[model samples]
Target: MRAEWVLSSLSQALLCVDGEGTINYLNAAAEQLLNCDHHTVLGLPLESALPLRSDKGEALKPALLNELASAGGEVKLRTSGIDGREAVMSLKVEVVRGDGGEPAGFVLLLASHATASSAAAEVINHLDPLTSLMGRREFERRIDNLVNDAATSSRSHALLYIDIDQFKLINDTSGHGAGDNLIKAVGECLSAELFAGDLLYRLGGDEFGVLLCNVDSFEAKATATRLVRAVKRMDFVWSNISHRVSISVGVVLIDQYTLERQAVMSQADVAMYTAKENGRGRVHLYDVHDKNLSRLHDEMDWVHRINQALSKNEFCLVNEGIVPLGDNARADACRHSELLVRMCYKGELLSPGQFMPAAERFGLMPQIDRWVVQAVFDYLIANPQLRAGEVMFSVNISGQSLCQESFLEFVYRNLRRGNVDPSLICFEITETVAITNFSVVTRFMERVHELGGLFALDDFGTGMSSFGYLQELAVDFVKIDGLFVHDIDKNPIHEAMVRSINDISHVLGKKTIAEFVESQVVHDKLAAMGVDFSQGYLHGRPVALIHGAGQ
Candidate 1:
């Protein structure tokens, strides 16, 4: 009667299994949870009613009772219920000894921990508080288990690392509250689109990760494309302002070929960044076609050579002319070649594109920038005629080096030490990196402006733009992006955008520069459209105005 009453009072479904895993008793809650009566459950094998299996499917050993007696603790057993619902049951098997202290049938209390919360909800709720999606801790734990299981079971899995495009722009303009709302909306969309077996994880701030088990590349890529399309269709409207959002995804298939979890993740990241470089708002798959890998290899090789060149002072400056506005409204007011820097590698001259990206990756850009300035100053000291009157030289400033305040101070110090006029040197910053850290960029521009230095916004109209931010940058020169200027005579839209930018810049007291002007037809069209200055094959190819020693 005591046992019967004890069975009647349990809140969780309780089950007592014999040493052979045959059901001996069923509590009232257990009957309700499994939708079966005591008569039906009792004397039946546990696995007949539940899909519960151990690391090995052999009936849970009688050793459980011995171990529980020694440990005095509970163990968790997970299985599916009679209705095929996933369930978690805690098992505590206590030793029941006979009068002689020999082991008899043990008492087992199996508590169902699987009420109300579905497996999906349970998984989602355990994520990080901020993102309301799988936290990094949970992600690592799950991946670790997957890897461990794969080692023995020979299963396969894949992970997709997704990054949102122009996320910072939203955070900056609309405030972080809007940003948080957008992130949640994206998470909800992902959750709805994924199937039951797949898991979508929010990997912190505008980045999400997915874990797919037993999925091949073809299916994985198809799913990824669907996700990308789903996201592409999503429009976020905040305070009556609507904006379209998109993502770049990098999918990595995990199998015997994948060395480790970190390596898999790194490959996905590389692929994601590759997508970014290709273009935003598109999906780029990881393949052997990406020349970046070979380029990266060459870049590493170039890094050593660049370092050696820098140490040996094997860099030189060759000025490219920036023509001033003239009286004819079409000719230059005496064009002068601004000192541009170059480095020699293995007896061959390497331009900025060949080595700048690698230099920035390896933390050598600032040193390279300073070396260029010093090299130009040395050239100016040697050529007094070039320095006479209002001479100006244009120097390319890297986005990475510009972010470092110390680098700016170094440039200022060098200019003063070289006795070169700050007004005579123009600093060129590409449009993409200028808007990266908007507030920091504005402050930097103001500092340089105070010293009578000039600023040129290079590659304008190339990056995704918010005209509001553009107006705020207030640069002195607007260098039209090559895409807009390239074949402008053929593309009316390109011509229109260039003309619009030119009009906007001129009205704001900023001069316009058209780069990549290839033909006389392009030059004539730009001049007719009132372009202030043009630079390209039509004007001149980038050539050395001054050469020596290594020449």
Candidate 2:
């Protein structure tokens, strides 16, 4: 297509300018927009042809024209119409790249009031009067567009939910005028920090939204932190009373995982709430793995279902056998199995991976732990032969349950009631759990050991203080983390890590159990490394201890 044909086809006014800001060409729409003859304005500078000013009536600076020529973005300004009346115009500036991809000149596209006055008015109506920033409605509109763009182009954006801390106190103590001034000052300060493509919006009274274009989690977090620090340093003087303000920011990354605009806002809101809950004047990034935020709407639903299941005894117990790897007769004589809990909801079996995270996050793990203990005891009482034999069941306990004062008492009570042998039970605690509630877990392990029950450190290699905790806590076995055991036969680093963990555990006189042992090669490797036990799909999947009861 011819350049002139394309320029004339555009309905918006188009002007071609040289590097010196001298106008060289004006399309038909541009001549009609300026209401001037094309020959008369061809050689004139942009400032001479069109008198431009800011919304506040300040003359447009020469520096801004230079910035516009190189900015490659759109900016809004007011210019005089043919009748000397003020007209709002949106100017999109683009660099005209030469054959060598160097900046040759510039093309300025002007969408004027004559062409889009109604649309411009609609946008202006959505601007906050005090801050002159886009309001919540426009924010929502932009978010929707960003969401659609992300879906189509695989682009990423970030949404920051910023809330001024103690803003209500400021408004209540000082007058409304002072509060308005503070808000305007904050808006200006934040706007100054924004880049060309970034957007700032006044979501509501004390809340604002920042739309960061094409940023990842790290960039978004850094920007949010900067915003928080900026707000913290802002000093507002009202009625001769000096006041300092801070902000709590919640950041959500917008990408393919984002379901919709509301989802994005909801995630950001949840993150903001987390920041407030943790402490004011901080930034929190939304974690997709966080159960509380992931199922925010269905939290109460899960709570109710879990409560119902606990009351009605709808939870089931399963077990997977752990086989001894070496030729240790003692290890082979004592049959070991890991106890897993599952839920039966509406006749469907649910794995612990689905509900245990929520159970732990909401402080319901103690109750669930008690239920699992009672269920295991009942199973032992029913199958007296297994309990009387050399079989020992390893029950997994959550960190929350371990810290509770009543959990240990509850376990003792169950043991006494069922008259079950403590020697047949072994409790498993993760390495992280042992390190987090160190004192309580140590006491719990001592109490269990005193009662002839053993303890195993689960996911041993995942925590930073794994070896240190193994030395501190008196665990009889260390279950190597599955991440180090999943493909040990194929990955040298994983094999070396597993070997190091095994050697360390042996040095501490604790047996090592390597989980995720999927292949014969892995099993043989673990045996050769002197690992005590191996557990994974190669052994057996978890099955109901009481056949047909859980299913």
Candidate 3:
């Protein structure tokens, strides 16, 4: 009775048959697998519940079952499915002896062909030919099981996504044969370092997945770090040329909160990409509270929101005036106001701080930039007096939008359609954006200048190559970074830095605008440094382009 109870609890299907080949009992697994009720099948012929056939596709006779009980050996049989399909199942038959040492009954242990192939395959499936580790299919199956178990019970696990860094360079410089050898070597090395309950899977070329059971965030992070170091230390030699290999690992904790297998794996993949982006050969933990990940999730939500906003015209344009500082004739001639964008949500005005980060991260900036430009152009056309006043509206453009060929065409088309003078509009590109895409930005600036539009390198002195690229980019204005101007009056170092930037801008024949000028002291200091313009709360806050524009 105890043995029968144990069999009933087994995940694999089990059955007890009498000496006459009549079914006596069926476990829960057997009932589910065969799609029959145990009470209904009891005392029935074994063949009635599961129509078993020999491996050769012939029906198994009673004599064969009796012989198998007598000999006590396993047999492979084919079972008929509900849809008339055949599925291979393995039957390990054990004979039960009576007191007189005669055959009494048989205990059958049943399993699917894939799970019963070999001892190793029982734990996994379809081991990789080269690495001898479990393949992608088995990995996915195990992850599904983990997810299901987590839904029922409280347990924690962690998944590590490992990707070889600069793997393509090795393949391109050497050959495919070398790449194959390196893969095998790395797989072997990693497999050797795994713990007892851990599993390593080769998830296709140059990528692997490690399922670490019963581990928390700290342990998982430590394991990931060790794995990274181990990969970096691997001595890979191909064709007498030594190759160094490193891996980026993304770690994500799995628990009841984990939505599903696909979502968990996607989280790991995102963390891995973050590691690669932050300079490879590192481990990144998937923190729900992380600003970037939070922004990422918010970005996905905002993608739809932004599209809806554009269609429904939920966006508003505002402007902040840039006041002249010092006795500069050019500053007096240039009437500048920076155009800012805001979104209307739930009957309240949402500043750029709330949604622009999401837009930038999710590549929705181009669409938003186009909307801003079109709206600005429309406003200028409606208020011809503003255009005739020679007011230069410095509209900020995203780096992504500025890099696209279509954006330039869009700008030109809108200018022509609005019949607005290009000189009255100045596009603002950040210093970092200008420096990162120097050549592209240079060409863009030249084209804009040809169209009579001016360019301003915004947030100056923030990028590493700001000074170098400043000489290359053709712009009319340079806005000093707010960080330098925020406390320039109190901090001598900041004051000196602002002075240096101001002097350099004058040398380059560009007008300087000091940002974050919140007081008369900061504004006066900038004026003392010959800064051409000042913008902040001290000058004026951003107001709607058209008055009485409320959400």
Candidate 4:
């Protein structure tokens, strides 16, 4: 008893067991380490303390007693106790040789550390320690391995890349602890569903990946369905707050005959982006036939070029002429043209088509808008003879800029500094942009109106659905979209759209201008429609700012 007590006090874990592998004694250190009192664990059988094996009572690994009897000095093996929580144990077993020089029973003195060394840490680092699931690195590594294996074996594997929908919003509203719990729940649910060969990985922050080896197309699809269903059924709870999480999955089967494993993975990535584009919570297979990826690459490149253009001041605005509603009505009156905006880039004047959509996507619309405003002001300041009343300059505003109070403030300060008469400026905002944020639009329009400014809803007839929203916004003027005016000469529908819009504007007590009036016939057709004003190449093309018509 004294020897047992002394040995138990000297080590982290010390236990005595009979030849039948039943634990008879456990000392103070073992109880303290395992978070149990000695009295509770003392007489518990070894298998009962750590029930890792099934009910059949089979040991997960060979019994430590058999090994200790053979090698009496130091024996190293892994074992777990107190509900299968792991520990690394180095056992120094004392084999009491009987008078016959045969081993009696071994007294095992054990010391342990729960932590692992750096080498083991690196391996498990690719696995989430809490759930023992693959991480991003492990996911990728396994995928790579499977790809190589398939190449040699002439088999195929599939990768399912998944993104949790609206996870950021949830994470922000809930605490990070909740986010962590949610992720752990997902990992657990996925682990429960996938078989031994399939691997689930959390690829950091609401994105996960799975590598399914030896899975064909049908099996891959079925696995994706299983994963989606698993995620759907899981109600992640943290702090008693529960929420459902859904996922969008993109799958790519390795084409070992044609592409490398990395390429196959990249194809899946592109497909994942497509799934996101088509709205979330659906699975999409990688379609190699689609050229959308090429277009996306080009668009990204174009976005970068546009940003560079803005930085280098490589873009300029051209002023198109906007005449009065009745300027050409009398047929002989002095026709004063209102200034319209066009853009010049790389020493060539480009229409709005060249960059507007790309600009909107890259969030460069506000900067482009600011540049337009500044350009008009700079031109007016430079050409002193072009007085405030000489011509009204129409500058376009982007929806993105309108949503920003900082942009509004900046516009106000710049306009005030330039001392440009606000009334001489006709600010053109698209109906689409104005209707979406009515409150901001109302406040901005009111502020600009107080400054003696005028606002025109450009592209008006395009969203004919917004008549009620238009009345609610109540701006100074409406410029019909060029689509209706461009084909008025040929398309009777276009003619009717213009006529209806013009009449509606007149009824609302607001003015309407016909855009894209490229010919006298179209201009005359609009005039007959009672369109207030006409603007296009017919009046004049956008030109560089001139003092007096390039004199």
Candidate 5:
């Protein structure tokens, strides 16, 4: 027991392999020393955990293990993780004997400074521990240096983003061990194709980045095509089960025109997705002029910006008034407005029209919606003036958020935690979203109504058969779609649709708000038609939520 405790306590990694060469025990330090967990390797053959190889990249021979009984062998340790880079380790093996003086098993002790070895630490920092690839950090740094290098030299380079096709299938069907083996094999296959001065790195899960040095567009495309075919030709066998694997390649040329490291990476990623979209196991060379790739590139750019906006507290709230149309507009309506979100990005306040489509496309709307909700809740807690039930703040939610099962809990928790006036908040979702996710939306709205909160269906008249949807949804307000409202005066069909929606909503005990009420003509027209409220330029423009509209 004491010996076991001592073995467990040792800072250096240790492993015990039975005479049959199966690992029976491993210390905690061994996990970190090799960047591995015991659940995958314990009770398995030592080679399953450590596929040791030599300087020539040949598998360590079985004869070497038998020789370790007398004079121990030294070999570099390898345990592939995400990156699969390895470091040199000093291995000393001692044979354990049974009472009959026969070999029971072997105790392999690690003797070296894991942290104290400067050479190992340097390799660990830059090279991936599982395979020979450099790693993502080094890949980025090298790109930056290479971009700067392009200014002085006339040599061209290219960035290729390689992604394993259907990698998740391997993990799901066979196991993660097979997935790891596939990664190692793919790395080897790719490395075999590298030219002198070319670099490769494991960019991330099932993805690799290759920096092809001294290659023009023609040469770059040729090389990328070769990479795609090479992976297709690889006959990867894991655990005696052969699995077919292929990779999609996206290539972006690097020249004097190359701007920054991130943009280059983004382009490569976009191109890779393009290849995958077309069909897996192909190559797509990025062309800035291609409309589809260009649009995807822009969205990728927004994805980065949106991530930054969330982390940096760059999102701010604004409100546009929703004033009643009749003579008693002020007394009946109070200070009602719909909350709008703006991003203070890169020294410019960008409206939702600028960034929202991208956010929705990339499934970032749920995160943005949460940020708005928490911000509004926290803001009300901080300021007493915004707490009154008279001032209702309507917030827009996206369909992606409605699909999330925990989103309702998140909203409920914040509302309960802050003790903010429930009636002062109104949640809004597009008519399309509310219709598609009808069941979840109904449950969410019913809960809000139960809490004395309100629900609004925004952009109401755009859908083909929305009147029927209105009959089922217990929404407190319906904001006529801006597409209809913006040209309501000029388009009689739009005006009639607006009037019909307004009358139906009133019959259902719900108020109606006309969006895009740009001119007095439209406002007066809405008033004459008995629209309950107006929200747009004519009534009021949006102002920062911290300061209320000047009544």
Candidate 6:
């Protein structure tokens, strides 16, 4: 009964066949799979008890199992049940030899196709193909189990987040093959140093995560430091060039306080970044009250929220009128409406100021910017009246997006695909973005110009080389920075800064727009200085960008 219970619980079906090809025993799983009870088929010939055909539609007899009793191997066959159900299974035959070293009987193990495929998929999902290290999915699984264990017991676990220092330099100089080789080498080096029970994972890119079980805080720190020192002494050789490698580690102790995997991972990530920030190739122990951790936790929350917003279509747009100021009533300003994005999170509408920093830090700006472009283009498609000629729309592009060749190609495809006039759309890039991605930004501006689209240099007068970059950007509008405009009415220094920016922009044939025009006094001063347009709360607040009048 005990042996029967064990065989009954086996996921794979099992059977026993004598050398004479007669079935003598069958487990519960085998009975169900063959669509018969063991009592009904135990004494029957194996071929007659459960008739099966191979994948090629050829019937295989019971004598095939007798032959496999000596040369053990497997065969693929499909069994058709009495209930009109069919199952494809791989059957392995093991030789049950007698004490005389002669074949006596055979033991059969059968795995259904569905079960085999699922097992293969589990391996693919949990492990990274590049380094053969467990990936984030596996990390979360083990950590969640450990967290649950910690809740009921005093068991302690430590999480160490490791990032390869200056890894981008290797990729940039040696190409991706070299980078991949280095990653694999690093994984092996780290794995060699881990204890038998320790867990290591590749958390994507040049980052790895380690889980140290049943360790105290002091031991966890020492382990993290050892790993860092181990990595420091390693040399990775690629294509005849020998390069030194190092990793910065962040160690977080998971005691009774860890609520979930995300909390510990985020804390470890925060500590890892701090270690990198305080100069790479070291370990930083996570403190509950660490200021960096607190800031990073908030940013991590925002990152999750931002991703949710993008996927759920909770992101929306509003418009603030970029009204023409005085005689400088430029048609470009009159034709354009500033399109600003907001997040409809829960019941509240969040401005870009609330979430933009997080979006920038985690490299989500490219995705967000792509979402905005597609959304704006979709809106224009739905509303023909809003297309380029009558009312031009200006959308802000991120510095991160500006640097990608794919993003530039995406913009070009949209411009050529749409019915909307390219001349009616304006792409606003910040002065800092233009300067930082100088060549890429220049190439983008040239392409947009060729397609008849307009460019606006936003947040002007902020950079030290603001005027110097302005001479080369060829933007239709130079938006004066709000820092200088916010206090233009009170401070002469700010007034002079705005004045000089406006004058330089005009000399280069670029229209100037003053931002943060909060009062009539500020408005009049900007108009007197010949600023072409103004956008501020005093002129008009942001209104829902509906199909009709609200915009």
| Candidate 5 C-alpha lDDT tens digits along 394-461 | 89888988887667789987776647888888999999999899999999888778878888998998
lDDT of each: 0.72, 0.81, 0.81, 0.69, 0.80, 0.82
Candidate 5: pairs in clash: 80-130, 84-130, 84-131, 85-128, 85-129, 85-130, 85-131, 86-129
lDDT of 2 by residue, 1-551 (tens): 34654454344688887766678887766766667777787878767675766555655344555576666666777877767777787777777778998766677777774556477677789989889999999799778766755664456889999988778678867968888888898898889887766799999898999998777899999999998888778888998999988888999998877879988887787788678767899999999888866655355357668999999989988889898986863546777889899999989989887777667655689999989888877777676677534788899888877766668788876765647788788889999988999999888777777778888999988898777767999999899999999888899999999999999999999988988888899999898988889999898788888742421
Report the lDDT tens digits of candidate 3 across residue range 412-464.
77766648888889899999888878888888788778878888889998899
By TM-score, how accurate is candidate 1?
0.46
Candidate 6 local accuracy as lDDT?
0.82
Off by over 4 Å in 2: 1-295, 329-331, 416-418, 547-551
Candidate 6 lDDT score at position 541: 85
In candidate 4, stretches whose alpha carbon ends up further than 4 angstroms from where it belongs are 1-149, 167-206, 236-244, 273-279, 289-429, 432-454, 464-466, 487-500, 503-509, 524-532, 539-551
Q: Score candidate 5 by lDDT.
A: 0.80
lDDT of 3 at 310: 82
- Which of the numbered candidates is closest to the native, going by highest lDDT? 6
lDDT, model 2: 0.81
Worst 10 residues of 1 by lDDT: 324-333
RMSD versus native structure for model 1 = 15.0
Per-residue lDDT tens digits for candidate 4, residues 402-435, read 9767789988886667467787687878988887
Pairs clashing within candidate 6:
none
Model 1, 74-121: lDDT tens digits are 666666666676666666667667789877656666655553335467
TM of each candidate vs. truth: 0.46, 0.49, 0.53, 0.55, 0.65, 0.73
Candidate 6 runs further than 4 Å off: 1-127, 135-138, 165-179, 237-244, 330-333, 387-389, 547-551
**Candidates 2 and 4: which is better by lDDT?**
2
